[model samples]
Target: MAKKRKVVDAKRDKNGNITDVLLEGNKNFTSTEKALGMTKSGLIDLVVVKRKDKEHLRTRPDGKKGNNLDEMADD
Candidate 1:
């Protein structure tokens, strides 16, 4: 059986170009492609990289502490 596709509520600006999209899927790609209106199988054709989106994933300002520890002077 095929997976159910969710009804995506896409957001657009005054120019009518799609800007933001909301869908139900993985924290990875399915939701992203759906929001971008790509075929479900299309996302699998290419590599989907999962990078840390500090702005979206960061819950606190010090989330980068571990990464910056070496570069930043200890206080």
Candidate 2:
């Protein structure tokens, strides 16, 4: 059997905050959050989307569905 190696997907900022995260490969922010039992505001930072990217990485809250950031920004 081949041994699987652990991957370091994210690195913390100098302030100890999660500066960046990798959605590809072995780890991601949300996965790490759930694993560490991190709830509330701490999780917000993990939820991110690239404005110029065509795909919406996350879904909007109830009643806010079908609206993109630009559409929502107008309100």
Candidate 3:
């Protein structure tokens, strides 16, 4: 059997962009923070990455490729 995909209820803005998402059931806040590698204050730097085949590419704050285009980082 194929694995089921989890669905989330999203809140969008007037432009049809996702602003927030909610998952089902009650989850522990501490556990969620720990799982996301976030502190209690929820302060972290995020990097948006795109995938090209098996390689993951990093994007800059402006959503463009940086000076080095050879997969800077990965999870």
Give the winner by TM-score. 1
RMSD of each: 15.4, 14.0, 14.5
In lDDT terms, how accurate is model 2?
Answer: 0.35
lDDT of 2 by residue, 30-62 (tens): 343442322222332223344674312232344
Residues forming the 10-long window of minimal summed lDDT in candidate 1: 66-75
Candidate 2 off by > 4 Å? 1-8, 25-75
Q: Runs in model 3 with CA error above 4 Å?
A: 1-7, 26-75
Cα TM-score of candidate 1: 0.29
lDDT by residue for model 1 (1-75), tens: 455343223344476433443334534322333433343344222123346851111112455554221222122
The weakest ten consecutive residues by lDDT in model 2 span 37-46
Candidate 1: RMSD over Cα atoms? 15.4
TM-score of each: 0.29, 0.23, 0.27
Candidate ordering by lDDT (highest first): 2, 1, 3
Give lDDT tens digits, candidate 3, residues 11-31: 344764333323334241222
Q: After superposition, how far is residue 25 of candidate 2 from its true place, in Å?
A: 4.9
Q: Clashing residue pairs, candidate 3? A: none
lDDT of 2 at 8: 28
lDDT score, residue 21, model 2? 32
lDDT of each: 0.33, 0.35, 0.29
